[model samples]
Target: MNIYRYEENPIITPADIQPYHKGFQVIGAFNAGVAEYNGETLLLLRVAEQPISDDPNKVLAPVYNTGTGKIDLVELDRKDERYDFSDPRVVRDVTQNATFAYLTSISYVRIARSKDGHRFTIDNEPFIYPSNEQEIFGVEDPRVTQIGEDYYIYFSVVSPKGIGESMVSTRDFSNVTHHGMIFSPDNKDVLIFPEKIGGKYYALHRPTMKSIGTPEIWIAESDNLLYWGNHKHLLGLRQGMWDSGRIGGGAVPIKTDKGWLELYHGATMEHRYCMGAVLLDLEHPEKVIARSAAPVLEPEADYEKKGFFGDVVFSCGVVVDGDIVRMYYGVADTSMACAELSLQEILDSLVYE
Candidate 1:
């Protein structure tokens, strides 16, 4: 195997960070956006929290109240005939097309400072919380790209309206400027390139369809960082392959001499998520050059197979140094983990198509 798993494996867990409130408990601390700033490594962790209930049947959901500008805990009965609380993650309205009623847990981005890139100290307060109406449910899976001195963090904002992409930028990690929904609802896993190409900014995103089409990677161009257009369908699932189930952009596409190397997460029909590689044309990134016949990384470790959502290795970011790519990924949707891969090795793994 080309993967060099960190000896410590999961470096950050839910126990490492405390919940923002008294009654709420931290359920997950993973799916982080990684960046390097001021001689330290930063993990923009997706901290998931839910209200602790004494009664088993009483399910409490925290919602960001747009009217009062506060998070209101709404209680629901598991035994209620109009709803289905079978899924521990979400409550569904049995009355209306089995739609999502409320999320069992809410997620927000937090900064974890690591001087050595192994050990980390997590912050108590959320760096980006559910502030506006767009993030009523919460923000999840942040992907950071450094352009010049500022670090731009792109994340998912889940609300009753739908899941969308939102961005925020920080220089020192202390403060940030909010740039509202970059892509509208039903679009996520958006990764913006570090620099503009051909005097235009480029990005990779996945927008799901309701009645037609499977989840596939798409490319878009932007003049400014905010407004995006010139959308093109990039990659789709390969039948009977590891990514036959679904596919999305993982780490930010790394510029290479051969081409633009992208690390993406693909799932099987059984919902087993693994990491794969793809190579794109240098100038026109929308043109695909090669793809992975097999997964570059999969759920081999115990931590990757057992947790909040098992059989998953989802990466939001990585820190690159020459040939060494230090990948920080969320394990089973529970904790954060690190692995080192040679950039050349990932490129070599791709099969030219």
Candidate 2:
């Protein structure tokens, strides 16, 4: 595929975002949801922030307490033998056999606006944060779909209950209505189609199964957009291939003459993430028309191969303007970047067999 990355790649970083609260430091600003609103390009960025501590030996995790209605910082001693801090993102308690863990940083969505697609000015305050028990840990990886005048936001809500999909809608970006948790635990990467299909709204979701099942993409339909049903498996992990580990939905599926063009992310068992495309039947979205035998985009750049997490390029949204498709993606779980591909070029690259 002929992919052209922006010269000013890594467009948004932690430095662009201010901490949501005092005494906290912004760690990452990535995985943003893209949209064109009010004659400007908008990015709903996932900003990760962590509590800053003077003591180097102590690791602090910011947690939102529902009862207290405030964020509490939990201090974990680095020398503590009861926990494992092998991963920079999470701290696992050894006593529970690593069954329990907490994120080093709490993530929330913030807005960044740009007159041109490349340069952006981020808002000092967060656009969305953890407000209820369902999102006590944090809210993450948002995908926005504009339906009529209303834009629906689908994101992952993390808590003790497990990660699930939640819905919120906005029109003017000033006022938003939370529709609560729409998908149950252990599900995420949910993206809704911009319009109704067969007189019902449709969505693509990924539900992770711990035992016998691998992480795969699934499709569902709903009449009211809140209550979804008629679930069907859409795609599965290709063993020994680039996406052998897992696969999930990315960007809102782009509608075209050929089919619904979906730009998604896949990973190997080695944890290397790449972006690829798949074409689904327009009328019956559950049917896969074509899939990319090779990744359309990969983690080849130094910025993508080294960061908070390495060897990853995951996209949350894409904007189609005529023949050009601008994809906004997160690099190595740390910062935001943009790349462009011809819409027809991607369709031609798909393997039918």
Candidate 3:
């Protein structure tokens, strides 16, 4: 099967996106969640902000201080440290027990509007920020779904405590009701279903266990949006496959005659991310009907192959229209890109055998 990408897509760029944090400068502005509201396409961009460094000798990042409502600059010594800072995504301590931390990439959800879903106008202010102590480190990827009149947004909130999914609701963009932390730590990539089934809410979640199990997509049932339980493993990485390293749910599940169609991201042991799809039973959300034997999208373009973090095509959202699926994805963990594929073509590629 063949997939199509928009040559003129990825409406926003670093040059077009404005910085959200006052003192810190914006760096990675990609992997945004998508939604359409009031005749406009809205993009919830993951804007990574850090201090503007002038010194060639040090790496500086901004940490939020809630009490002061300001960001504090944290400096890392590149020369003295035993750790190697060669990779943008990971930092390795060579002299020690091989300790590492993914360099600080705090995310703020900024808004950009599009009338045609190709050309967008970004807002000067951010829609969400890392305000409280729990979100001091920063917020990362976000997934948005609209059910009825209310819009439900789920995102990863990061801090010293741990990383987990949080929620907020809004009818209009003017006001948002923050429900705070909905899912516990060691969890993220939670995509709530657009509608409830059998009076129970359904969501696709990933529970991160570094040693025990790789990041896998699971289904969870909830009576209320705040509490979630009754988990069932939906999908996992295949050995020596495109998704051998880890997997997470991408755009919110799309309802089709076949089932609940989900587009998700997977990575290799080297952390090269790509996009694929899975079809699940409508009645029993945990039952997987079929899955794409191969990735629908991979890092082939120049922008996708090289950037802040290269060889990645991570997606957080999509907008479906009739038979066409307009996908918005993060390129190389640095820039936002878009592509279009046929809904039927993607479904036909799913292999049950």
RMSD of each: 1.0, 1.1, 1.9
Residue 287, candidate 2: Cα error in Å is 0.2
Q: Can you tell me which runs of candidate 3 are displaced by over 4 Å?
A: 82-84, 89-102
lDDT of 1 by residue, 156-229 (tens): 99998989999988888888999889999899999999988889999999998888999999999999899999
**Candidates 1 and 3 compared by lDDT, better number:** 1
The CA lDDT at 137 in model 3 is 73
Per-residue lDDT of candidate 2, residues 1-353 (tens digit): 78899999989988877787889888889999988999999999999988889999999987899888778988899999999989898888899878546889999999999999999999877788899998988999999999999999989998867899998999988799999999999999999999988898999999989767899999999999999999999999998989999999999999999999999999999999999999998898989999999999999999899999999999999889999999999999999999999999999999995
For model 2 the local lDDT of residue 98 reads: 80
Model 1, residue 236: what's the lDDT? 96
- Reference-based lDDT, residue 86, model 3: 82
lDDT of 3 by residue, 166-209 (tens): 88888987699999998888899999998888899999999999
**Predictions ranked by TM-score, top down?**
1, 2, 3
Return the lDDT, model 1, position 124.
Answer: 73
Question: What TM-score, to 2 decimals, does candidate 3 have?
Answer: 0.95
